[model samples]
Target: MMQNTALMPGSRWKDPAFWMLAPATLFILLVFVYPFVDGLILSFRPMNGGGALANYITFFTDPHLWKTIGTTMSLALPATLINVGIAVPLAYRLRHKTRYQKIATTIMTIPLTLGTVLIAQGMLSYFGPNGWFSQLVQALHLYDGPVRLTHNYWGVLISLVISGFPFVFLLVLSYITGIDPGLPRAAATLGANPYRQFRHIIFPLLLPGLAMSFCLSFVQAFSVFPSAVLLGSPAGPTRVISIAAYEAAFENYDYSMASAIAMIMGVVQLGVVVVVLGARRLAYRGPVTGGKG
Candidate 1:
């Protein structure tokens, strides 16, 4: 029989596992927790000698600053949806090991190897007005002049897709491969068509994973900075919350306002995650574990 041994006084401090975790816990307290708390405190302070709520009031009252939330959501939400939608079918196809799957996954993950800054630069050069695509379009008489692609909203959207899709794909692929192979086969034996099999079996199991992937991808997209500046109309349509925060801090020298904006950005991402996870709970009432079969 396994005995439940109660720890003696001071034994917890003597434990090797506790010692092992101490450094990491200390590092987290210093690096993440302390900085977050400091920022939170700074966010409520006055920027230029005003009330405590001055920075927050300015952010909410200023049309240009407040508009950034809508711009960010406009870009992030669509990109997240597209990434998750494309990832689901692609990951489903790649669940099984095959030569084609190997080749496809390798090609799909090529974007993962490239950083967002590098990807933005490539998009600017390759999809710019004088680039091959535009030249071809002009040659084909599709338009009278060079099409504006880069330094616009579309460029940013494409960059988000290129960078975000692989992450969503890898996550969904792991969840898909974790599912028992026999579950789908059983559905097939029960005379279910491919559509029915996926609807009744695959999708239900994938919902929890899909929700997580959506939240992660949305957060990544929401935090986009380099790509938005390089490949998008940052001064106009694609001026995201990050840019606004950067401008408030570095350009305007208003650290308090910047901290407030940063806090709001975190709150927005957290709210979306909570909402999506809550919806996932409502949608799926199945057994926690997929059967061994």
Candidate 2:
């Protein structure tokens, strides 16, 4: 008797679509899952051959190591806020097609192409103590002394902004444009001014995207190492968590400690992401777009 192929066990595996996921699955397993598991295991293995918790305990007990969290947060939070704050309004303004929109976007994207180290170098030249900005200030008699911008907190902060703002802007712009133009127009027809329309409609729809953008920007800023070392005082003000992790792995040749620090960093970042994503649920849960199918 002939059996039905459709009813055969494991028939679904024969389909091409089922096999199509193989590459991505293999990639994730090799690249992400394997590394994460390996790192997690390594974090528990201390170099001094102590207890499983030795790495974590040492990280917490050492004031110098623990303090990197606060330093990273100080820089990350402000930079994320500044980038999102600026991107939102600017994105809202540029959402609709305009003559200068392309030009503006091109200019904004220039920074993204320039990596962190290049941006730090450029900032050092432009915003350095005796750089053009300081020279211009002096030429205009704006200040008696040279303007100090690099090798400090402000230097790192500025570098973060320059590198981060483009990402935030593009992400926010995509969300804003996805919104139906009719929503704002309808609000306008109802006697709502531009401000009121945006307040009632645009801003509400943008919150979810804003939260995501903030999380991403914060992560980028938090992982700052090149900028902190090149632009800011790495040994003091800009000694971020990445620097601690780097020192552990490369400088001190302690892979276990580095993995532990990395795990902690991931946990902190995950916490912020979870909180922001949770808060997003409180916003409008309807379709992101105003248009109907």
Candidate 3:
């Protein structure tokens, strides 16, 4: 057999794939990994030349500052759940083709094309207390006055859902389609009901993808800054961790403290992602036996 081109000692250097990957590796090192390491080191530098942990101490010692963790989690988790929940059923229904599929997909994906800032601006104009959504609700006597939807926690929550749903839906739909369509049909032929077919044949295979979608959408929500500022009470209910880092860096001009806050934000996001991925271990993957069927 010919020696493996990728593994051969001297010839490996001539491999086209190695050269193709080199630029991407260098870009990641320079653009992503380097900044991360620099920020991590800066986080250790105390505000007044003390130990690295001093900023961390200040972070945890202050109840008001620390409480932002709870605030951020409250928003991120719910938004993620809502997006995943809606996406799963919608994706399942859309797995098979229909004439309206393309149109529906394009509509749902509109938010992806629009930036968060644009969406925030739209929410302010359309969903604010005196805007169309509120005015319509008031017109129908749904409330005593124009309902408060923006410049608060609810606004940020809505913003996250609008921005995150398409991403989750697209991912889940792709996963759903990847499953052998014949499997579900076979289960149906065997007299399995819709719910049973899903629980036994579909859900297991989709678990990994759903877990990944949840982690990605949660990270997106966790990093909320513009929506929190424009469509939320940044000083109050919706003061997410990104805002804290922003204030520490730009407003206060304290890079060390800012870096520490940034690090904390990353740690919190990582913890949530780990917990979600860990929960995937409990899901059924497939049959244990060899492929005898």
Report the Cα lDDT for residue 225, model 2. 92
TM-score of each: 0.94, 0.94, 0.94
User: How would you encode candidate 3's per-residue C-alpha lDDT over 135-217 as one tens digit per residue?
Assistant: 89888998997789998889999999998899999989888878887887898999999999888877888888889999999
The true-structure Cα RMSD of candidate 2 reads 2.4
Model 2 TM-score, 2 decimals: 0.94
> Per-residue CA lDDT of candidate 2, range 74-105, in tens?
99999999999999889888987887778878
Q: Each model's C-alpha lDDT?
A: 0.89, 0.90, 0.88
Clashes of 3: 0
Clash count in backbone of candidate 1: 0
- After superposition, the stretches of candidate 3 with alpha carbons farther than 4 Å from their true spots are 1-9, 288-293
**Tens-digit lDDT string for candidate 1 (62-168):** 99999999999999999999999999998888889888878977887888898898898887777999988899999999998988788889989999999999899
Residue 245, model 1: Cα distance from true site in angstroms: 0.4
